[model samples]
Target: MKKIRNFCIIAHIDHGKSTLADRLLEFTKTVSQREMQAQLLDNMDLERERGITIKSHAIQMNYVYKGEEYILNLIDTPGHVDFSYEVSRSIAACEGALLLVDASQGTEAQTISNLYLAINHDLVIIPVLNKIDLPGAMPEEIKDEMVDLLGCDRGDIIPASGKEGIGIEDILNAIVERIPAPVGNPDGPLQALIFDSVFNSYRGIEVIFRVKNGSIRKGDKVKFMATGKEYIADEIGTLGLQQIPKQVVECGDVGYLISGIKVAKEVKVGDTFTHIDRPASEAIVGFSEVKPMVFAGIYPVDTSEFEELREAMEKLQLNDAALVWEPETSAALGFGFRCGFLGMLHMEIVQERLEREFDMTVITTVPSVQFRVLTTKEKLLNISAPSEMPEPNFIKYIEEPYINAQIITKSDYIGPILNLCMDKRGILKNQIYLTAERVELQFLIPLAEVVFDFFDKLKTISRGYASLDYELAGYQESDMVKLDVMLNGEAVDALSAIVHRSKSYEWGKKLCEKLRELIPRQMFEIAIQAAIGQKIIARETVKAMRKDVLAKCYGGDISRKRKLLEKQKKGKKRMRQVGSVEIPQEAFMAVLKIN
Candidate 1:
């Protein structure tokens, strides 16, 4: 155990974490040069295309130093704030972390957030200044920032460049010397923490875990602490380029256990696995269940594919425990599933995967945050979709979730960023100057505001230099009301949204204008109105299409033409009184894009 090190790499997005991992794999000779690829740990095609890590991956490497063999287990974690929960879980399974900071960009919002997470996990954090080979690299300034933020000695910081393969040996040596070895009782009852899981069609559910205590072997009967389900371990292995089977995975080691459980819901991320015959007395501490923050309805464009979409979601849930979904029907979009996700990026990734991998085309409703509703009779209910909301008279009040948001950016663009935040009803919490050029600002904003295009706007206002990170700060009482879109006297449930009462007029006006552009003109005029309760706050009309009813009356009497025109006008009046508008799919999608 003295020669074994279990650690992970944590960083902000696009900071070369995966590149550094690739270099480490090369130096450790884990994969041959001929078979190596870029961002080896980022196995997902979407991750590769987007240049981001979406999932946590673990790999075991063997290295020899000073004539002594050492076992190093490196777990690569996602760098985005949307996957912070995955980062925390990965940190919990390790003994140390390599804090990678870009020498050019220095510290970012997510970098600070990940550093705190590593500190909370009580892991040995070895700060590494990466990308020293870049033209804009400033190692001295980045070193100072790291020391100030981490409160560590200047001599402890290591400088390296992932692209140039510089300082690779130094990083390896530091991992061996600075990071402590994992300490656990091999003789104790079996206890392992499941950090992640994947579904295999033939092998059942394969769980990736860290052996906190005791050992697991093939054919062992294991029980999940949370679910109390027993399954025989079909195989035990370590993750290489592929699964390398082993007879036993001892304590203080990271590996995969193949349990003969075909159902994904049977296994959870934070659950503990123990030998059924000699189970541990208690489960490990700090087991946090993943919660969904944003909710939306996903409907198949072809209603016949509804069951296919449902099956696809079920299969996806087996792999992504963070995903939650249930059957839902929309008046406009028809039957579908209301799905919950960690955030907007997660929601988008899921949608993309469903389209690309499952070959299913789907229509997604506007995303919403879960709201707490208090009824007149003093009943409390949770609502995820606007359609789920009770009548206006039945509710006493509503509470919306809020987040503690932190942003890091240069000082030059503070004015526009502040204005943007204020427009979103943000309440400033605190501000700090990280350096002469950079500033860190905090705010308490509604989660609904941040989940939608807020990050994109922040980047645009700050010239793509701003980084944001946020945490849920619980729900707060606010003056929020449901804003409904009415088309030809009918309320479109899919277009309904909850907004702050103060901004209702502006939002209603903007929504009405957007719908007018999206909805096509019909034979009769279509009145597009935005309403709060029964009162219309904004309205726009799509003029009826005109037809020359008397164009074919050439050489006929003028009176004949007049009679034909009068008859056509009466027909149009009747059509206006009884005709219902048919909104196309493009209009539904267009309204969702309205900011």
Candidate 2:
């Protein structure tokens, strides 16, 4: 155990976390040159295409120092704010973290947030300045920033360039010298924490965990503390270039276990595993269930494929444990699932994977944040969708979720950012000038406001220089109302939204106009109305494709023309009553583009 070092890499998006990870792997020769590629740990094609890390990957490496061989377990974590849960899980399984900062961009919002997470875990922090080879690189300036943020000595920060392979050996040496090895009683009771899992069609669910207190061998009877279920360890191995089968994975080692369990929900991430013969005293500490901030409905285009969609979600959930969902049905969109995601990006990724991976065409409704509702009878309820809202007479008050949002950018863009937040009904909490040119602004904004297009707008106004990081700050009572869209008098529940009273009318008006442009014309006129309770807030009409009944009787007398027009009018009124509008898929997605 003295020779085993467990650590992970932490940084902001577009930073050198994945790039540095590649250099470390290359220097250690854990992966051959022929198999090496950019962002080697990022295995998903979507990740490669977007140049972002969506999942945390773990691998084992060997290094020899001073004529002694040492085993190193490195976990590469994602840098995006939406995937912070992945970073938290990775931090839980490590003893140290390499805080990589961009020498040119300095420390951003996500960098500060991820640093706090590592500090809370009491992990050893090794600061490294990456991209020193770039023309805009400012190693000295970033080193000073790191010193201020981490409170470490000047010499403690390593200056390197991931693209140029500089300081790779220095980083490896720091890991062997600074980071402490895992400490546990190998002969004690079996205790392990499952951090992640993946599903395989042929083998079953593969659970990846780190052993802390005892040894686990092949064919051992393991028991999960959370589920209180027992299963035989069909196969156990360490994660390397492949699943390297071992006779026994000792304490303080990370490895994968296959139990032949087919069900995905049976094995929960963050659950502890122990031997049935000798169980641990309690579960692992500092691990809690993830709370999703954004909720949306995902339904298949074909209603009959509901069962298949459910199965696809289950398998996807096994890989992304942060995703939480429950079966739900909608009047506008038949049977579907109400999925809770960490953020909009996480929701988007899930929807794309469902279509690309499972080959299931799906339609997603408007995204919303969970609200707290109190009724006249003093009953408190959690409403995730507008359909779950209680009637106006039965409700006492509604409280929406808010977040503590932090934006780090240049001082010149502060005015526009403040205006954007204010327009969203946000309150400026605090502001500080980190440097002469860089400023950090904090605001308390409703989660619903940021769920739409706040991030994109901020990026645009700031010229892509601003970075945002946020956390749920709790709930606050607000003037909120439910906005519903009706097609020809019948309410479409899927298009409903719970918005602030001040903006409900404008939001409804915009949605109606957007829908008018997307909904195709039918045989009869269609009335698209946006209403709040009994009052219509906004309305638009799609005129029917008219045929000239008077064209055939142009040469007839005035009385004959009047008679043909009367007959056509009666037929049109009857058709309007029986005809139903078939809303295209684009109309459902168009609600998001409404400014």
Candidate 3:
């Protein structure tokens, strides 16, 4: 047990975490040269194309030091804030973390946040400065920053470049020397924690777990603690370039278990597995529960495929435990599931995965943040969608979710960043200068404000230098109203949004104009109106497509032309009464595009 070291890599996005991971694998000879490639851990195509890691990948490495062989279990994690839940789960399973910081960029918001997560789990943190090969690398300055942040000695910080393969030996030595080994008794009853799982069409659900106590062997009777279901362990294996099956996986090791469990819903991430005959006293306590920041509806393009969509979602949940969903029906969009996502990016990835992996074509509604409502009857309700909001007359007050946002950027952009935050109803909470060149500004802003275009705008204004990390700060009373969009005077529940009363007028105007451009023109005029209850604040008209009625009247009398025009006008009026507008898919997406 003392020979096994479990660790993971944590960093901000684009900070060479994956690149460093690749170098580690190469140095340990875990992956051969012919089989190795860039971002080897990020096997997903979407991850490679976007130049980011979306999932946490686990692999084992064997290394010999001081004439002794040591087992190293490495889990590579995503860097984006949206995938922080993945980082947290990986951190929970490991005993130490490699905190990689970009030398040129220094430590950003996500770096600080992820470091805090690792610290909370009481994991040993090894600070490593990456990208030293870059021309703009500032090893000395970043080292000082690390000293201030981590309060560790200057000599302890390791400067390395993943691209140039520098400090690989130092990092390996640090992991073995600094990080502690897993502590468990092989004689104890079986106790294993399932960190992640994936579905297979041919075999069944493959569960990836770390043995906390005792051991698991092939053909052992395993019971999932949460589900209370029993199954025979068909195969047990450790993860490598490929899953290498083993007859036994003892304590302090991570491996995969396949048991002919075909149902995706049966396997739960973070659940505990024990021997059915000699089970552990209790299940292992898992990581913190996932808190979703954004809520959106996902519906199949074809209504009849609702069941198929549900099954797809079930399988996806097995892969992504952070995704929370419940069945719901919309008056306009029909039946669908209301999904809670970590952020907009998380929602986009889920939608894309549904299409690419499950072959499910889906339409996602406008995203909204959760709201708290109190009615005159003294009943409180939690509202995720605007359609669930009570009538204006019955509501007493509304509270919106707020977040504590931290922005790290160069001093030159502080003015613009502050202005953007203030425009989003953000209140400045604190500001501190980590250095003369870098500043960190803190704000308290409503979560709903950032759900749309705040991040994109911040990136644009800062010229891609600003990094943001935020956490829910709880709820506060706000003058909030439900803004509804109506097409041809009929309310479309899918387009409704909960906005602050002060900004509702401006938001309504922008939404109406956006819908006017996105909704296709039909035989009849489509009046796009944005209203709060019965009061219409903004309206736009999409004119009907008209055919020239007088084109056939060549060299005709004025009376003839007049009669033809009058007949055509009457026919158009009748068509307007009978014709219905077809809301294009882009119209639903226009809500996100509205500035």
**lDDT of all predictions:** 0.89, 0.93, 0.94
**lDDT of candidate 2 over 241-350, digit per residue (tens):** 78899989999999999989898889899999999999999988746679998999999999999999999999999999999999999988899999999988899999
**Cα shift from native, residue 120, model 2 (Å):** 0.4
Q: Which residue ranges in model 2 land beyond 4 Å of their true spot?
A: none
Which residue ranges in model 3 land beyond 4 Å of their true spot?
Answer: 555-557
Q: How many backbone overlaps does candidate 1 show?
A: 0
Clashing pairs in 1: none
- Per-residue lDDT, model 1, residue 424, is 92
TM-score of each: 0.96, 0.99, 0.98
Lowest summed lDDT window (length 10), candidate 3: 576-585
- Cα deviation of 128 in candidate 1 (Å)? 0.4
* Candidate 3: residue 58 lDDT (0-100): 98
How far residue 387's Cα lies from its native spot in candidate 3, in Å, is 1.1
Give one clash count per candidate, in the order shown.
Answer: 0, 0, 0
Give the range where candidate 1 is weakest over 10 consecutive residues by summed lDDT.
584-593
Evaluate residue 287 in candidate 3 and report its C-alpha lDDT on the 0 to 100 scale.
Answer: 86
Error of 2 at 20 (Å): 1.2
lDDT of 3 by residue, 1-595 (tens): 9999999999999999999999999999999999999999998778999998999999999988788999999999999999999999999899999999999999999999999999999999999999998999999999999999999999999889999999999999999999999999999999999999988888889999999999999999999999999999999999998999999998999999998888887887888999999999899999888999999999998999999999999999988999999999998989999999999999999999999999999999999999999999999999999999999999999999999999999999999999999999999999999999999999999999999999999999999999999999999999999999988778999999999999999999999888888888887787889999899999999998888988888895999999987987898788877877777778888889888
After superposition on all CA atoms, how large is the RMSD of candidate 1? 1.9
